[model samples]
Target: MLAVIRERYRAHGFDEIETPVMEEYSRLHAGIGGDNEKLAYNVLKRGLDADAIRGAAGDPAALTDLGLRYDLTVPLARFYATNRGQLPSVFRSIQIAPVWRAERPQKGRYRQFVQCDIDIIGDASARAEAELAVATLDTLDALGLEGGSIRINDRRVLDWMLDSFGFTSDERPGVLITIDKLDKLGPDGIVAELRERGATAGAVDAFAAFLRRPTTLEYNPYGERQIRKALPDGAPDDIVAHLVGIGAAVAASRGSATELEGDIPLVFDPFLVRGMGYYTGTIFELAHPSVDYSLGGGGRYDGMIGRFLGQDVPAVGFSIGFERIVDLVSERTDAAAPAVVLVHDRDVPEGELLALKAALVREGSRVRLEQRTKNLKALLERAASDGYTAFATVAQGTTPASLEVKPLA
Candidate 1:
């Protein structure tokens, strides 16, 4: 799964970069939330001596000084920090690697999984965000995933709504965390949950009502409230009209008759509430009608690299959950068993065997020659039992120079 995705991104002009699995504990804590940091697996150092190793076995937590990578994006930022001068102005990369998270293993979630990520750095425009959507659509199309919609929203818009209701930055994460559940728990359920969490009734009700309202906001280069202020009373009809116009523009530009809108559905779902703190402008999720959880998601993070470089380098990207994609592909397509052919040519000249193998390969047959030499009848029987379509005999061709090809059936 990771290899396929990595190749696809690489073909699309992305350079493959690798980051250290073992990171300094302080470096790993940069910008990540408390819960995410807690999920990291600390790389504990064991003492060299046998006695020390045995003594430290009972209290191994004290010996750890580093942590495994929680996600690839942060480490990429760190890499950019050290090697920024050596990199190009507009950077594109794909990282397909394992990340560890100490979470209770459940459906679609795991302790260790591979994240297939593609990111473009050093740009700050709505078109960059739109390209994230386009790349995501392209990737899913390549994978043959069906009935998935890319839901999009801006974190700035969410921030505006939160601040408009008098919520501070400190309160914003918690509020966004709950509002993240507006879909799972309906308005009433969310209101109840907020109240249970000790939010005032007015704040909860106002927040709930605001969230339940039309999610489409005018993509204001300035801000959402300013866009509303330009309009009379910030009517939902006007906001929706702006959204429809922008969404249409997005569709017309990215979606031709082929890449999207037929098997893979792309819709403007403004209600998508991606809870990552790093996302700045546009955030999105890919949801399937058959699967309850999102297949994967990503968004724009303009400030992420800024924190590391001391200068803002806008970027947008997404990670595909490779395991989920494999499962989906397995369920969606009828899989065929591969044919295996065992070869008994260990003592035979290598060049002759390779030539025989190449001849069969050129005929468009899925032929694999096993190198182990065994009794000819046993090899033939095993090849038949292993579901081979055909078998070939490669030898010195003494007396007769012609080749013998036998159907396994």
Candidate 2:
């Protein structure tokens, strides 16, 4: 699967690059990750710094100078900033690596997991969003996951919705955070949380009405249509055009790949307030029909790179939830069996054994060589259980030509 991902990204002109696993503590705590900042595993100051921390200080900020990276996006931004002069004006990058978080571990959630991300920096056109969405969906289709849906919503749409409800600038952030929990809490739960967070009864009522409206459109199963009916009276024209353009691009791209056409649903979901604080424009999430949670998500962050370089760099990215996708794929696919297992007697000549192993490998066979055990039956039984389909035995003075392959029961 990783090979497939590498091929897909490289095929699209994204060069793979790796950034340090640990970044400066201040960078990790930059508030760009939203709630993820609170989950960072701060590295304690070491040596003399540790001694100073132990002696005095009301806050630990001085004691912590570094932290494990919470995500690949931030590190990539920093990398691009430090090496911008050497890199292409329009940089497309692929980063597949592990990130750490101190959050609670669950079935699909973990303290340490891999993230597969591809980002295009320097392209502000809606074409960047469309290409990213199409390429990622194609990768999923290549992996045999066809019954999934892509839900997209622009941050501007959320801004318009909040303004329509008369939410003040100071109040909008808190309200957006609550709305992000709509999937887990439901509409009633969101309203309750909002009221508890100081939203007025009228504001809560208005927000609830917006969610209940039949605005969310599923483009694949249901046909395509204008989303203007769902927007507020004065929703920005550019935002509406962006959504329509994305839908059309995805639809047009599907023409050449008929087998995968309509197999993956695409929808416009207004309530998808992806928890990241850096998302400035379009945001999207991928969900499988059989699963209740998102497989992964990403969006445009035109302002994020500028925080590092002091100049705006438009960017869009998509991440595959590595652990969750692997979990789902494992459940549906059978484990592959090894082609052959070579069982050699301890007294067998080392040179002959090496020759046999090398010969099998040269023929492109998956092979494992193990010293023959006194309990040969038990050894073969264990190998068979571990998905070895065939075995070859080496005798005390056997020549490579004398060995015969035996099929496992």
Candidate 3:
């Protein structure tokens, strides 16, 4: 799955780049990571004496110099800022690596997992967004994932919409938190949550009025009318138009037989407030019906780079939750380069086996040499499960030319 995603990203002109698994503790906690910051694993500072350790209670972060990265985007921001002069004005990078998060162990949640991410730096325009969405959809299709769709929204639009609703600046954050729960809590639950949180009475009442309207937000793939219906009158036209353009561009590029809608696979979700607080503009989540959770998500963070580089750079990224998607994607079945196993009797000389295996390896075959065991059937079944497509039996007198390879049943 990683290979397919990485190569698909590379094929789309995204250069594969690697960042250190550990970054400065301060960088990880710089508030951009959203809730992930609290989950980062801090590496204890070396050689802390009893007094130093005792003093650290006052400033726990001071006790750690570096920490495991919770996600790739924050590290990528630092990487771009450091390497900006040497990189292209519009840099496309692919990061597929493990990230650590200290989560309470549960099904589908782990302390460690892999993330497959592709980010575009330096292009703030919708083109960067379009490229990311298209590339991600293409990569999903390449992974044989069906019924994938992208849910998109803009933070700026959320702000504008909130302002229009009379939500004070102080009330917006808590309001967004409640809004993010719309799918889980429903319209009535959202209103209840806001009221429980003591949101300004007028704002909560106004929002509830909109939610209870007859033209409630319904799920659709994408369109101007669909978007307008989702929001009250006078939603920002520029942001609305930008989202419409993104949907059109991605739809025109997709050739899926399993599109979410009859036409496109992009959903303009006006309330998609992704968890990341750094997201300044467009935010999106990739969804598939097989799972209730999103497969992945990302958004534009035009201000993050400037915090480190002293100048802001336009950037956006999309990531695939590899641990979640791995189970969803079955082993690839491409027969172009099938794996072969050499089942050999103990009598076969190591030199002869090596010569045969080396020959097969040079000919572009993944050759695994397994000694014949008593449970031949079980061995063959295991090999089949491991993705070995064909096998050949070899013994003392066997030669490469004389080998008979048969497809595994």
State which candidate has the highest lDDT. 3
In order, candidate lDDTs are 0.67, 0.82, 0.88
Q: Across residues 1-409, which tens digit of lDDT does each residue of candidate 2 receive?
A: 8887788878777899999999998889888998889888988877746558767566657878899998999999999999999999889899999999998998887999999999999888877877888778877876778767788889989988898887888898899888888778998899889989988678778877876776545433312233555565677888887777776667667773322244435677777889888999999998888788898999999899898999999999989988878866542323343478899888888888888888877776677888988998999999877777889988776665787878877
Report the C-alpha lDDT of model 1 over 211-274, residue by residue, as the tens digit.
Answer: 5576556443322333354332433544434333434445556554322332224444444667
Candidate 3 weakest ten by summed lDDT: 253-262
lDDT of 1 at 396: 62
For 364-403, candidate 3 gives per-residue lDDT tens digits of 8888999999999999999999999999999897888998
Off by over 4 Å in 1: 1-4, 45-63, 210-249, 255-271, 331-340, 345-355, 358-367, 371-390, 393-409
Cα distance off (Å), candidate 2, residue 267:
0.8
Better of 1 and 3 by TM-score: 3
- State candidate 1's TM-score: 0.75
In model 1, which range of ten residues has the least summed lDDT?
Answer: 331-340
Best by TM-score: 3
Pairs in clash, predicted candidate 3: none
